[model samples]
Target: MKIQVLFFGITTDLVGSSTLELNIVDVATVADFKKSLKEKYHQLENLNSYAIAVNESYAADNLLLKESDVVAVIPPVSGG
Candidate 1:
């Protein structure tokens, strides 16, 4: 299945792109997608934590992804 991934904040720097069209095995879960991303982009593993949002809503690791789903990688935010 194919999904559109959006990178926010520092994630964009880590992935080297604000958006990506990626392919994954059918019925892949959010956790699976995160693992695949960490494998493909090792820099992503450097983050302390991040959130995965599917179709504008925060998604759990078990959420099953669907073709053409829009996923967003939102890195932790820090400010004074």
Candidate 2:
């Protein structure tokens, strides 16, 4: 399955791209996708934490992903 991934804030810098079209195994879960990303982009593992949003909504690790799903990687934010 293919999906669109969006990177935000520090994530974009880490990945070197604001967006990517990736091909993943069918019926992969959010956790699986995340693992794949970390493997492809080792820099991603440097982040303390990040959130995964599917179709504009925060998704859990167990959330199943589908073809063409829009996944966003939002790194932790802090503002004073």
Quick one: best TM-score, which candidate? 2
Candidate 2 residues lying further than 4 Å off, grouped into runs, are: none
Best by the lDDT measure: 2
- Candidate 2's displacement at residue 77, Å, is 0.5
Q: lDDT per residue, candidate 2, 5-70, as tens digits? A: 999999999999999999999989999999999999999999988999999999999999999999
Clashing pairs in 1: none
Report lDDT per candidate: 0.96, 0.97
For candidate 1, what is the TM-score? 0.97
**Candidate 1 local Cα displacement, residue 54, angstroms:** 0.1
Q: Could you list the CA RMSD of all candidates, in the order they appear?
A: 0.5, 0.4
TM-score of each: 0.97, 0.98
Error of 2 at 62 (Å): 0.2
**Ten-residue region with minimum lDDT total, candidate 1:** 40-49
Q: Write the per-residue lDDT of candidate 1 for residues 1-80, one digit (tens) a residue.
A: 88999999999998899999999999799999999999999999899899999999999999999999999999998899
